[model samples]
Target: MSLAKQLSTLMIAAVLLGLGARVATHSDLPFWGHWEPIKLVAPPISIADDAMAKPDSAFAKSTSAYEVNLAATMVLHMKRNKSNIHFVDAREDTLYKAGHIPGAMNVSFDHIDKDGDKFLALPKDDLIVIYCDGGDCHLSHDLAEFALAQGYGRLAVFTGGWAEWSKETDLIETGSGAK
Candidate 1:
C-alpha cells in the first residue's frame, strides 16, 4: 500500500479498536443497554415531628439572653446562700480541676447516667445550677436536660459557663470539686 493510504488505514483501525474496547468494557453495566430505562426510587420520608411533638426536655432550646444573664445572677446569689443552691460542673475532671466556679461540684455526665435514678433522687425542687467548660460546651446542657427529665423543675444551665466566669479575677475558684 502507498504510504498515505497505509497511514489512513492504520488510523481507521486504531479508531475502530478504541471504540470496540469502550463498548466491550461498558457492556456489563446495567445502564449501558441501548434501550434500558433507569428508574430511581425516592427514599421514604420521615414524619418525626408528628410522632414526637416536642423534645423530651424543654431546656434544649437555645437559652435566652435574659435566661443566661439570670443564671449568672443566680450563681452569684447561690454563692452567698452557700448551703441552699447546688452548682454542678459537667465538664471533664481535667478542665474542672484547672479552674471552675467556686463551690461547684464536679459531677460529669458519664457518672450521672450510670446511676441515673439514684443520681436524680435528690429533691427536684432544689435549685441546681449546671455549667460546663465554656459557651461552646454542651455538657451543661446535657446535665440540665437530664435533670429536667428526672422532674427537676428548678434546674438551670449557666451558658457562659466556666469560660465567662473565669474571666472575672475575683469571682472565686475552688480549683475543681472543693465545695
Candidate 2:
C-alpha cells in the first residue's frame, strides 16, 4: 500500500478500536451526544432570576459554572464555616487530607460514583461553590456539571482553587474529619 493510503487505513483502524473499547467498557461517555455550540461571549445570566446575584459579587457565569475570585471564595468560606454555605473540594482524598478549606467537603470527580452522595444530599437551591487545584483544573467544573444535571439551582466554581486558597489563607484543615 502507498504511504498515504497506509496512514489512512491505520487511522481508521485506531478509530474502530477506540469505539470497540468504549462499547465493551460501557463507558458513561455517550457515543453521540448533543453538544452546545461554542460562543464568543459568556452565557446569559440566570442567576439574576433568583436573588443570588450580589451587587458586589465577583462571579461570572458560563453554562453551569460560575467563576469566582479569592475574595469571594473567602467570603463564601466564612459562610461555610458557619454552616450556612456548602463548599466542595473536587480534589482526591489524599490531596484533601493534606490540606483543605476548614469546613469544605471533598468530593472527587475521579470517584464521583462513590463521593456523589454528599453532593446529592445538598439542597438544590442552595448556593454551592466547587473548587479544585487552581490553574487549569477541571475537577470542579466536572462536579458542577454533574450537580447542574441533578437539578442544582445554584452553583459556583472557584477558579482560584485550593492552590490560591491555601496560599492566601491560614484556615487550612489537615486530615479528613466528619465531612
Candidate 3:
C-alpha cells in the first residue's frame, strides 16, 4: 500500500473507530466477512506456450513463473570466490545452529525486518544469496523481497535452498558471518 492510501485508510478507520467508541453497536454485526477461495479457470497451456513465455528447468515442477536460480552456481561461487557474493540463512536460530551453507549468516526474516541495516551494512551491490529449507520454503523469498525493496541489487534466491543443497554437497556449517 502507498503512503497516501494508507493514511486515507487510517483516517477513515479512525473516524469509524471514534464513532464506535461513542455508540454501543449491536453484536449481530459481523466484524469480518466470510471469505471463500476464488476459483480461477485458465485456458489450457502447452509446452510451446510456456517455452515462449518463460523457460524453466527440465525437472522444475511446471511453473509459469521465472526460472529458479541454480544452487550449484551459488555453491561454485562460494567455493571459488568470497567477496562478490554473500549468503543468508533465513531459518530459525536452532535450525541454523544445526547446519547451514558454509559462511552463511543466520539472518532470519524477522532480524532483517527489524534491523535491515544489519544486512544493509554490507555493500548493496554485492550478490546476496538467500535460502531456507528448500522446497516450498518462502523465508528466503520474503527476505529477498525486503532487500530488493530496500534498494539492494544483484540479488538471487537459492530456491532449491538447504534441502536441495545439502543433498548435493556437504558444505554446511553452524554459525553466523560470511566468509
Candidate 4:
C-alpha cells in the first residue's frame, strides 16, 4: 500500500488503543470499570507484633484453627454436643434477631470493648465455636480476638458461618429467641 495510507492506519490504531486504555481506567464505565480504584487501595500490613502482645498469643498467633473452613458437618457435630460446646454468634443483634445458627448465642462485638473484659462473663473453658453472617463477614474474627483476650483457650471460628449453616436442609432452625 501507499506510505500515506499506512501512516493513517497506524495513527487510527494508536488512537483507538489510547481510548480503550482510558475507558478501562475510568470508574464510570459501568460494572467492569468499578474495580479500578480498589486496585489503588493500600495493601495489608503485618500483624505479627500486635498479636505477640496478647496473653493468648499462642492461640491467636496460629491461624490454623482460626482460619479453618467449617462446613455443615462440623456444625452438626457441635449441635449434637451442644452442652459441651458453645455456639457464639458474633453478628449484630439485628442480624441475630433476623436469623442465626440454631442454638447459637448472640455476642455482638460492638458491645465488647477493645480490652475484651466483657467476654469474660462466659465460662472460659467452654469449647467456643465463633461464627458471623458468612465468609465475607469479619464479626467472627472480632469475637474470636475478644474471646482470646478474655483467656478462652479453646476457640474455633466457623468461617462459613450462617450462610453455610443455612444451606443445610436437614439442620434445625428456629426463630430469633431460641435460647
List the global CA lDDT of all models. Answer: 0.57, 0.74, 0.60, 0.59
Model 1 CA lDDT for position 110: 68
TM of each candidate vs. truth: 0.53, 0.70, 0.57, 0.54
Candidate 4's C-alpha runs over 4 A off are 1-65, 72-83, 113-118, 170-172
| Model 3 C-alpha lDDT per residue in residues 65-133, reported as the tens digit of each score | 122345443433444243456677787777888888877777778666664656777677565667788
Model 3, residue 14: C-alpha shift (Å): 11
lDDT (tens digit, per residue) of candidate 2 on 1-179: 89999999999999999989988998766568786532222232333333233512333323455666787677666656443468888999999999988878889999999989988988775677889998988898778878877877467778889999989888899899437
Q: Is candidate 1 or candidate 3 better by lDDT?
A: 3
Candidate 2 residue 38 C-alpha distance from true site, Å: 9.2
For candidate 1, the per-residue lDDT at 24 reads 85
Give the true-structure RMSD of model 4: 13.2
- Can you give the lDDT of residue 70 in candidate 1? 33
Give model 4's TM-score versus the native structure.
Answer: 0.54
Summing lDDT over every window of 10 consecutive residues in candidate 4, give the lowest-scoring window.
Answer: 37-46
**On residues 1-179, what C-alpha lDDT tens digit does candidate 1 reach at each position?**
89999999999999999779879888554534566322111121122323112212222322211134333434344443543456778877777788777777777786675535544655664556677866678777777767655566655566667777777545656564553
The worst-scoring run of ten residues by lDDT in candidate 3 lies at 56-65
RMSD, each candidate, Å?
17.5, 5.2, 12.4, 13.2
Q: Is candidate 1 or 4 superior in lDDT?
A: 4
Against the true structure, whose lDDT is highest? 2
